[model samples]
Target: MSDVLKLEAPLGDVIRKSKLKAIKSIVSSFQPINNDKIEFKNNEHSDKNISLDKIQIVANRFITIKRLGSGGFGEVYLAKDKNQNDLLIAIKFENINTSRPQLSIEKYVFEIMYECSYIPKMFYFGIHNEYTVLAMDLLGPSVEDLLNFCGRKFSLKTICMIMEQILRGIEALHNHSLVHRDLKPDNFLFGLGMKSHIVHLIDFGLCKNYRHPLTYEHILYRTGKTLTGTARYCSLYTHHGLEQSRRDDIECLSYIIIYLAKGFLPWMSIKNSNRKKRNEKLMEIK
Candidate 1:
């Protein structure tokens, strides 16, 4: 299996007529080295639900300090690296028994996106008993939190600064032929404490490469891609069940900028009991 998630793409006139050599030339403009191969280690332990207070990640002794969040996948904790002057890190724990692929896919994407500074720094992945754990640099509050704090809006200067950081992150992703289908204020987080001005893009569960590696050909566009991102910020193509491309990310970011400026989207109040109806209404509003 390929490291990139396999999704059906739509066929379009532009994609059909694209010259392979020209596509390869454009891809060559970026500086991504091919390192798609990833291998994960499994821990030989009996306990599946790893208790942070009782255990530590192997290789590097990252001691758990407190739980940050938890959901169906597992728990995320704020931990300290005992060997590194109690350096803070975020560790996510997932039961190895589950069939969910979030942990594996996330690790894969992190490895491919490692060179991008705007992306989060992944320290390592390990197993604690029967749980698979991923450790990363702890980031600070998201733009969503900042928007709420400022009464749902930002000053002109702050908005410009934030958008510049976001565009840089998106450019990095596109340079690697990857498209971040899901984009919103919650996914763009500022670094914590001393790294405050630096913004990091997180959450890769919905990320995928949009071009073939060997041929550098654009993936054919496809339909029936389920709603893969936040409803309020999703692109019109997404609402229409069309394949998302690089432009979709830019479009979603534009919506986010509008939200930062106007507090809320005009379609925020539109509601329909049926999900499809809601999405259609959103498209109409757009």
Candidate 2:
């Protein structure tokens, strides 16, 4: 066991104030896992923990069948488009505090990298009355949720198979020099039924695009920030907001594989953080 990262600080408050204006400045910047020591700042005010009904989703001619789920940036819904097309689309509604340029970047990234089997194909993205929303092909239950329902951990064979498919998807992003900075069990869908099921890569909202879509010389503007991924599985360079490489993806992939084999996170803390000292104790071993 090791020092695990957890925060007493009300991070939600800080996020809202940002209005998610910057590209890589969101919660993804906060290393949420093995970073271990967290020094809380009580300087932020919180976003109103509004009731679910407070925000609304209105798509043209599409009726919401049910809400698929919500994430740090937005909630995805299952819906039917016009002409009664049996469409499974995810609508992501980002709060003012979450982001908007994410919508533009996601479109440019996924739209260009079409044809990878596992990455959920994006249909369209645009502002629906000042709110940034995305429509992606709705995917099935995520692997993390499935593992919980499976009761026991996955078979080694199953884990390998899932990893293979995920790598297939990651390879596409790697080719484009983009990083799915937020890779986790929760981001993959293992599909439904007895036959071969589809495994999909979902949620590119936290994706890191290296192209630097706009022109700005600021370091954060030049590269990117580690704004939206979990720390346990995040690579070291990503912690510094550097655009990730194929090597970095491999590192994160290693962490997830280890997590599946063991029942807990590999770097999880057994004691309260002593992060300031002996932090690199495990570095030499790795």
Candidate 3:
């Protein structure tokens, strides 16, 4: 319910004149996810909307296997690297207009924190047809899934372990001048199969750099901006339209820890209440 305004223009178009060149800035910054056997076949239908049956190749390297999930931005599919031992990866396809900013932002953030053990590695980012696609390491089930398996609550020992990893991830992110606007159970994943115990922070789609790129000065505060991130875990300052800072990330992390420890937040049941009533109830809970 924050009032931050979002412009309805392509980020590449707003920031630079040439869309391809602007996108190339990120593409040129990193190596391909798999370069051994890239084979982008010329398809007359490349620009058409993507479907599982319709997709054969992505960036000439990964082939679609099945749809994994879909969100407001686009669809994610499980893909296999054709040249590298058929390595499994997740390919997220988002239409240019709706996904450009998020894709670009995520790539930029990954460029900064790719070495962090708690963060997923971005294998590649590029445009196919009219969609901006990102290929990243396929991770395992989220902590939210783990919570469900444990009957909606985490034991103190489990919560402590998970929180420790999460704190490390947050520290790594902050060390690079980034703030994860959305830090929730669903965004933290356990490694798949052999790497199960390793927790990774995923989905940088809502992350932002709190410091200026060049000067490295902290971004100044702004008010009345539209709310970003999940309402349940958003910092109280977010409710007042204040810009998110490193502290907000920590605050949201605190809320998540509280939820994991208690099973449910005190305000969860009153989420549907009117704004005034909700605020009053939340204040009482505080």
lDDT tens digits, residue span 118-182, model 1: 88788878777777778888877677766665466666666777799899999988887888777
Candidate 2 residue-wise lDDT, 29-70, digit = tens: 111111112211111112211124433445665455655544
The candidate 2 region of ten consecutive residues with least summed lDDT is 23-32
Better-scoring candidate (TM-score), 1 or 3: 1
Error of 1 at 194 (Å): 2.4
Supply the TM-score for candidate 1: 0.78
Evaluate model 3: give its TM-score: 0.77
Candidate order (TM-score): 1, 3, 2
Give model 2 RMSD, 1 decimal: 11.9
TM-score of 2: 0.65
State every prediction's TM-score relative to the real structure.
Answer: 0.78, 0.65, 0.77
For model 2, state the Cα shift of residue 278 in Å.
Answer: 12
Against the true structure, what is every candidate's RMSD?
14.7, 11.9, 14.6
Ranking by lDDT: 1, 3, 2
Top-scoring candidate (TM-score): 1
lDDT of 1 at 241: 70
